[model samples]
Target: MTRPSLLAAIAIASLSTITTGAFAADQLVVASFGGAYTASQSKAFIEPYMAEKGAKVLTADYNGGLAELRSQVQSGNGAWDVIDLELQDALRACDDGLIEKIDASQLAPAADGTAAADDFLPGTLMDCGVGTIMWSNIIAYDKTKFQNGGPKTIADFFDLEKFPGKRGLSNKPNVNLEWALMADGVPNDKIYETLATEEGLNRAFAKLDTIKKDAVFWGAHAQAPQLLADGEVVMTAAANGRIYDAISKEHKPFEIVWDGQIWNLDVWAISKASKNKDAALDFVKFSTTGPRLADVTKYISYGPVRKSSQGLVPEAIRTNLPTYETNFKTSLANDLEFWADHQDEINQRWATWMAK
Candidate 1:
């Protein structure tokens, strides 16, 4: 996929704006995390697949569809052909037989100029669900507060006396719990293992208690960046992409401390009863292939799923991309299994935590 071809792909995608008329009334309704990000996905893969397979693609929201999926499965009328879910959501969906097992061999092979899925980070690409985007809950700080130097680690987040201010924290246990445990003396390497223990969760909450009344619990992605940019909070947990956007716009001394950041793995899974399974699979294959993925990341600033996408970027810009192995080395992968098993209990605790 060269620059010209990339443009051609976008043009084809733009024309696909036509109402998937009767040529193929069949539709593959997808439940996903919808945003401008999905637009990039539509241009890069969905439209291409629609044109080639003569199929209709419908979009739906994921949070609203879980109950619908449960009901549809009971009725034996599953409507979704594919789902774009967070890592843990995909795992839970797979367990409930809401999705089908994917065969990697059926996907497009990486050859010559075409970027292939194999070029992705090992273990991130899967037989069924593949990670589509990379995001991290990194340490975002006010540059003006520390113009000469800024807070750099989980320890700094805990160090109120040295670099203290109102902090923004995710209400969820995934990243916040990990950050909490990290604050309580858990090594980055041992963060997840610590989280598996009763003491670890308690310890994490206890650490958070130190700043509880002062912490602003952002309920959505948009909130954290807005809070930081508006000085609603000085240092806090933030998504890397949003943090970057704020830094670029605010021109404030905002900087991200990647150390001990929690990585969010957004993954894609295909429906078991998809009408266009082959083409759906092709879409997945095309979406995650390194070159197209690289292009998507270059445009969106979200980390690419492929390991080699980092190479596609210029040396200077590579630092901003999460494809770099060093970035992966520093960030902790979310404990999807832990979250899957304890989501109910954790939700209760989070609710209690929030009530205070």
Candidate 2:
């Protein structure tokens, strides 16, 4: 009630308002498929996302992104605020009721996500998750091992006589199975179709057996570049970004054969239970916007999901990625939908085959 006490109270109130205002400007938590993407998000997505909304951003892991959502929904105790889900996981999330339908009205009618306006990536922006980063499954090899410099087609991956060395592969069956079938002379376009048949599965296993002794099945992303750098394996099928990191940083004599590269994406989705759903959605919107996307794309080596940001990225960083333009003459686009349906069956066969 005294004048000095009143003055002190006013000063305290002013300081609280300033602090809260600054904090409110930008602050959101995102669980994304981590690794290079996380670092890139900090540069391309998070920092800018924060600046745009006047909020500070935090990042976490949810590889394949929606796995955490699936686990949370199954356990009935969700923790993530927002996630960078993969397409298959996004589909599963919807079926499992882990995600709330995105409120389209929250976004501008002309916002990049509005498909009727033809702004979003092909078939990515419905009520499901949005694509944020895109990369490819590429054939990376040590140039020093081959006289002709290496094989071009997927079949060459099986030609141990011509390009003899230990090999590496992703532990997952989704992409590697296609490479297996391709090495067995299955057409790239018919890869998933053939794999659906028992004969195709047999042939893939047969091809895998040829290199089983020399193969190092990589269960983690970091293992590929490390295996490549330390000479643990001579050549392998690897994600383009991981190989890029190895060669780009250490100047490792490596190259990617894009002949049968598989395009992959990381999708962003909001948790159904997130009290900060609106704030999370705002974070997604801000992260995918032009300025932040371009900045992040440079270091991450993943292509921007938003078409608007493509022009903003520097030419050097832009050329390193597999863009739609680079995909023109090459074979790409694996059957993600098919994998979603048969991952369990294929994974079983993969385990059996690897055991042999």
Candidate 3:
């Protein structure tokens, strides 16, 4: 009850109010593909937004899929405020009313004052989502295996006789099927169209049968790089970012073949059930700007979705990006619509094919 004690308590209360009042009222929960990918996003997007808006930002990880988002939305009490989603998943979630629709005008425009619609790469902007990065699923080989030369084309990856080693492939069928058809002599632009036909499906599966015996399948992103570094498989069909991390961080002897690379965009989506929907959309707008998008490439090799961000990417790593002009010319743009429509049936066929 002393004056000194009462004064000390008053001072502490004032300090608490000053600190807490600096931040926004709502706590934002963001979900993403974890590890380095999320790490990059945290540095580029979350940290700065929290600092500027004084918002409390929390993060969670998920294997890329709509199931978790659906669970949250359908339950009507979703914990996540925002999520990073694959384009196809984003499209489906928007259609299913699992995520909030985005207005492209609400997004920040280019540094040059170009409209957001004009600044973002083709197919990067969508009705319900805005893409942040363009990533590739491509082939990578252990440099130690082929000192003189390695896989120069997608077909080289399939030629077991020439490469003469076990191949590592993702368990998912999307990229694998695309690669199979391209290697089987289908043109890069014609891959998805060909895949839509029964004959094309048969051809892709038949081509896969060639390497099925020696192929070592991986279920996770990290496992692909580890498979190459540990020499379990001489080469892998892997995300370019994983391969880049292996070579740059782990110092693994890996080489990427950009030819016939299947590339797609990863987008940010707001949860329809989120209590902090406006704050979530605010974060999306802040993150998708050119400079913010460019900052991400410092941690990962994925290309920024904004065309302007390309100029900001470091020169040394420019060629490594999926959207790099020279590399993109030979690469395949993954058809998000095709996968969105056919994912279930294709996945079922993939399971049956794998079971045999």
Candidate 4:
């Protein structure tokens, strides 16, 4: 071949390589609850998904609220492509048309070939969100505070006379209302039923009033553990994962109380305004599947949403998981639908109650 023709051919080849590399390395942003939870997600899902899809997964952190997402959607400026949020937030976002409706058929099936619909634990799959983990709101106490034995039940948490310490609770109404009713002798099965009525609502608030004077309210998941550790409060209602990190990583004197634990699902959803919708969908599908979901447990104790993923979790950590045999038996599922319907009313009431 002529020298000029050979030089042109070399230029064409180099251009092709550069274009192909650019297409192969797509990037997406995932917003999640930060700290140890985000770290676990990066290791278990983001890194592996990047390796497989030849994409970059940028991580952002939030305090588990939909305000930022709503702002982006309203302003038409999409910053995050995907988010890890609680089930109730996902439902609200979907209703407000801030998030994309997910096609469950696109989710990866179980290892045994079960369809995604049949494989995901009940209530985990939703209209807009795909649940990734089965986590719980648990009561964690400092072992040093309870020398003989720690508070065991939800009632004990509210009973200052029995447990006898300043308690720490999240500064939200979601799980606190349920815990109050449960502690007030409302049966586990009837928690939502009681919460749904005026009488039930009054009962819960009355119960909360018992401890309101002595309780220390925490605004973040990380703060709950810190409160217990710094001797600010002897006991706190914590996300099971945060307490797990406290005991396992920070070497704090903490033990989780399984009784009255409110189990809930943490889900992933795509923003409707996301420019990278296709890439975000691909990332979500890859992460919530069999091995990937279960792999998160190695870093944190939350159970995988997929039933098939349970077997992949090591037996040693099984007891710590929200789905563990003992823990599962006593826990109540967080009713996201109910919360979705009444969140505004409850929040207003909670604010008023807190102020008084």
* 88-108: candidate 2 lDDT, tens digit per residue: 677678657787566333433
Query: What is the lDDT of every predicted structure here?
Result: 0.66, 0.67, 0.82, 0.83
**Poorly placed runs, candidate 4 (over 4 Å):** 1-24
Once superposed on the true structure, which residue ranges of model 2 sit more than 4 Å away at CA? 1-27, 65-67, 74-77, 108-117, 145-148, 324-328
Report the C-alpha lDDT of model 4 over 56-117, residue by residue, as the tens digit: 88998888888899999999898999999887777678779888877777778887789887
Q: All candidates' TM-scores? A: 0.78, 0.83, 0.89, 0.90
Task: Rank candidates by lDDT, best first.
Answer: 4, 3, 2, 1
- The C-alpha RMSD in Å for every predicted model, in order, reads 8.2, 12.7, 12.8, 12.4
Instruction: Summarize candidate 3's per-residue lDDT along 1-356 as a digit string, tens digits.
Output: 01112112211111110011122447999998776778889999999988888888999988888778888888998899899988778878877988877777778889999989779866677767788988889899998999778989999999999898999998989899989998999987688889999999999999999999999998777788888888999999988998887788778889999988877778998888888777777888889999999998888899997888988988887877887778887776677667866889999999999999
How far is 23's C-alpha from truth in model 2 (Å)?
11
Clash number for candidate 2 = 9
